[model samples]
Target chain A: MAIPTGPMDLVYRVLDDQLVDVEGQRCGRADDIEFDGGLGERPLLHAILSGSGTWHRRLPRPLRSVGARVFGTGLVGADVIQVPWDEVDDIGSVIRLKARARDLGLGQGDRRRAETVARLPDS
Target chain B: MKKVLQLALGIIAAIGGFVDIGELVFNAQAGAFFRYRLLWAVVVGVIGIVVFAEMTGRVAAVSGRPVFDTVRMRMGLTVGLVTLIASLVINLITLAAEVGGVAVVLNLLFDLNQSTLILLAVMGLVVIVYFVPFDGIERIFGYMGCALLVYVVAAVHLRPEWHQVAQGVVPSWHPSALYAYFVVGVIGAALVPYEVYFYSSGAIEDSWGVKDLNLNRANAALGFSLGGILSIALIMVSAEVFAPAQIDPGFLGTTALGAQRAFGETGLLLALLGMLFAVGGAAVECAFSGAYTLAQFAGWEWGKYRRPREAPRFTLAWMIFFALAFVVVETGVDPVLLTEYAVIFSVVALPLTYLPVLLMASDRTFMGDHVNGVLGNVIGWAFFVVILVVSLAAIPLMIITQGGSG
Candidate 1:
């Protein structure tokens, strides 16, 4: 929640219209902004990143779309998705994540979507 | 500039995705019958859509989950499935109506066999959806959809009495049962439940979250309000031309002539393009909504953002529904009848789809501090009440007014 203000507050911006991830990679778009203060005071930008849930959640009711959505938990939680302020590899054509999304936490429960469509002919 | 561009997706999506066949047909019908007398319904529908859409967007942005994903948590999976089924039915009817609208417009332009033209229209839609990549889908449709601006231009061109229009904007006591039915019709059509399902699901597709709340709010207000305005404009033109003549703009062709009467030949071309685009977009949205609600409920991957092969089952479900709707249109059913029925059934499904989203928006575990504020709850409940009344009265009104023509 706390975004740093100065250069130390270096927000991992996707400059010049850079994208976050490509293909079906574990990396996702900036889903949320994490911040720090002491667990609570001068809340500042702790990190900027995406959630694994965003990847799978992008799909509709009965199926999960993992391409940009997501599939694992390692890329989730409070820490895995967080890369401090130092790990944002390079801000280039894509904001390449330092670690693979699979290493983040791809698991059975991770990529599945909740059922929103009922009569989908079980294919 | 990139920030502007990223934000432009929200705006363009709002603009192009906002207006649909529902707005085009219903507003024209209302305008022909009541002029500005039912103007209040459009305003109300706009407010209702804004309250709920903003909530759904904020939930997606803050909680990182779309509304339907939370529906199962609140209602057990079975109840949630019931909602999905009900919502799917509404979406099917909506898709059929839009497909029919597409066919009718083709018939207007080419005078082809309605059945053959319907299949042609469906094919056009399938090709558009099948090949287009995901990211470009919204921007492409939204921008190309701006051609609908012609209806608003035509309304202004007609120059109706501003004083009389202002009076219609004020809600009045109308003794005519038919007029009351017309107001309910606009309210029903203007706030079709699938629009929110499609809209919020879209927020998820774009990977929006707490940071993008502003853009989401702007999308709801700008996109839906623009849609509501277009609906009113269609009504205005109809009222200006047909009200005096006492001619009902029942068919797609008649509605086009409403524009044609005001803008001459240019109006006809603009009307054709506008109707085709609006109807086509609505068909895509309704089909996807059917897919989105089901996929989100079941924990399956489903999105246009992915290639069809990636989420094969989810894509298959949506594609099946889309294909079925295409077939339904091929039966030569009248689009006007199809839309009227869709709106009424949508009135029934309204309470079901909305209640889950409203409750989810306020859930502390899901939404955290970003949950609905006091004003949000107030507006949300107020709209729910309106939905309840319409749900209760939809059938009776349809019977009593004999589908609003009596």
Candidate 2:
């Protein structure tokens, strides 16, 4: 269960895999990956990006802006969920995290939607 | 005793749940037009579904990831988004047809206006989703839909030539384009993508894990095969009753009359009641399947297990789907026609929906020791080729046959 090394390893093992929390709940998928360090240096894995904003960037150029606009996010500055690599416990079929999904703020949209529903007058 | 009862009930529910509006109408039409000719197609479709459904269910149970989730992972965002869009369009058409079918049955049972009944059907579905628990939804619709067993009884009672029925199971050549159209339509209706969406998501909702793998296999194999039996019975009933009279059963009422021909007023009542629940269950399946694909792909909170307030986006998706279907049905379009169109178009999306599951199910990295065995691989790849052929031919045949009207 050694952590996968090298860029090729990341492509097959980390990028686009589903994120699972400690309790085995699905958080989201790794739509995009963030890296750090300059050229000639070892590029360290930084964060796993999720959400429609990040996903839209992965679409074709013609579709990227349209997807962002339709999904209610800006193409360049949309809300890309950045989960630090430190939180990742394992990476296989799914990126297993050491924390809960809600604790990691992954359920922010769900919580926000729930708050909106709460404001509506009950029938 | 209790375990036996459970197994029997599951089989019965599968039988009832299997024959939705698409199967009811298309299979009946197939038999009416081609007599016993298209039975081979139904057999092929049933086995194909069994293989794929078991694969999807196994993938869901073992990995705790549903079909759409795997679809996005394996196919990547660009292709996944295209699949999502295609699936959504097909689901909308199907949802409209199913709700419309429910209204058609209700109108037959009662003397109500079709438009009013369509609205009522939408309301009924919304209430069921909002108030009923998931298990309650399954048992209510699943068991009640069993009234369709009357068709099986009617098929047997009509006493068609047994040898002809057996021969239909063996593939026969028909050079007509209309025959090919019905073949594709039957397969498309049999293996609609939404069924996989609903089944895999339902596995997650039911909390199935590795321990439930056997249950998953039994459910897919027994449930779908029995459902196929109900489909074959429908064809036989139509062959016995409609073919001789030269009646083209283009309407929902005409399909039910096959049952009435064999059993009279009591048979008519049972057929209508069965159609009501069967189509209603399909409406729920289509609506939920749409919501599931969108929510899972977008990584939004989902599941009928949570309150509407808890899974607001998921709840909103299905609600919007039902509302849109309501508008479409209210346009006074014929539900039977809508079903035929939906079935044909869905075949085009079949490859996009299923290709991902086949890829992941065979990958040992994902499926681990539970990866598809030799038989699974052979059957899986063989059906993949078959589905690809059907997907390519579906639209052309539709145009050539004018939706099989010849």
Candidate 3:
């Protein structure tokens, strides 16, 4: 019933989502997570986070490139991609989001988002 | 705590976000034309911006989305597209004026020719904006923008009747129509829609959530109210300087020169600084506003706070937007004409821009438990109605008045 979070708890939605490791690296965010309510067993949080590709289907092709650019191809190791829970040394003021930011494949999917957005009305 | 620093950031951004080229030229213009009699409209605009900015900041903090995102989800594609086009036009026009304004400032300070400096200034802004950290740029401009307060000092030096200015706070049906027009200009300049766009998007860029609502209110009120104070000072100075001379200011340069009437060389430096930074500050806000609106419209990750590479699409949109302003400026368009068109177009887009924010801020889906409280709704709706009326009359008024010069 309790999620061990403070302000950070408010940062998310659809609580109990999975956060997977970055492709071939040790970092990623909670793309999807599941929680089991078994009384006798230890409460388990299975977060399923991959790369930006997880949200790619909803995005059109051009939009997908935006995701790829901001995240990564998920085929190679990079910063700005998803950061897994383990790689998070801690949640301080800065997201400390797996300090390997220097190596992340930034802007990998920018074109995709731009294209998809351009096609839509900017309401 | 660190939260306090963040709150300070919000306040600073609010200061930078409060007034723009419209206020710079129009407010001073209002003073030159009508003096304290039109000061009420400035106050009305100030209150309107504060109310709208408050709602927008609240919306951003609660929904974790900027104003455009909410507009898109609420208004849907067709109407949203219309808003974007309108907002973009105003942004470009305002951007042109500010770009020209920067040139004028440099002209005043360095004795450079305005023509020579115009393109150079626009390009310089595009370059700084391309690489400067969004937060850093905002802070620098926001705090330094405080320099414009010297207007208040000069206005006070003249020692006008406070009660007469206070009397203008309420609408007078018995007053001259020209007086009414002047009042409308003050309000029009103050309630410029781009200001609210820049404000709300700035809130999102700062990553505000419900926890920051109080700070949002504080910043909107404090920073904007202070801006109002400076605007009134402009009105007073113009009343004092130009009224006796029977001189009407046709250019922003003349408006800056009015600063000399009350303060001497010291006044000149202060006015120059104010014009330079005021114009510069507005440029930054409108530019980011352009990018944020486009990015939010399409659901792309966008914020000045984010690295350029991280929000590539967003950054590119802004860069392109800035580039377009270059195209407009390089054409040697008159900034005053540009300001006139921009203000009128902003008047046209008034309802579309504010309505969506009012709707979403009231809705539970996006706001969750943090929806608009009673005071916010009342103020928001009241402003909505007023803006609608002004928007309806703006074109006709412009036509009849021949864009206010007639």
Best by lDDT: 2
What would the C-alpha RMSD of candidate 3 be, to one decimal place? 9.0
Question: What lDDT tens digits, residue by residue, belong to model 2 across residues B1-406?
Answer: 5443333323433443357776787888899998999999989999998898899989998887789988888888899999999989988988998998989888888889888999899999899877887767776777678788899999999999999999999988799999999989888777888888888888887777899898888888887887888899999999999999888888878889999999999999999998898888888888999999998987776889877776778888898999999999899887778878888888898998889999989988778999999988998999999999999999999999988889
lDDT of 3 by residue, B81-189 (tens): 6798788888888887778777767877888766678877877877666656656676667667777777888888888778878886776543454555555566666
Fnat, 2 decimals, each candidate:
0.00, 0.48, 0.09
Using DockQ, rank the candidates from best to worst: 2, 3, 1
Docking model 2 quality class: medium
TM-score of each: 0.75, 0.94, 0.76
Residues A56-90 of candidate 1: C-alpha lDDT, one tens digit per residue: 33335565544333344334464235444444555
Candidate 3 runs further than 4 Å off: A1-109, A112-123, B1-19, B174-177
Best by TM-score: 2
lDDT of 3 at A13: 34
Q: What is the lDDT of candidate 1?
A: 0.68
Predictions' DockQ, in order: 0.03, 0.49, 0.07
Off by over 4 Å in 2: A1-8, A20-26, A72-78, A100-105, A118-123, B1-18
Q: Calculate model 1's interface RMSD in Å.
A: 13.4
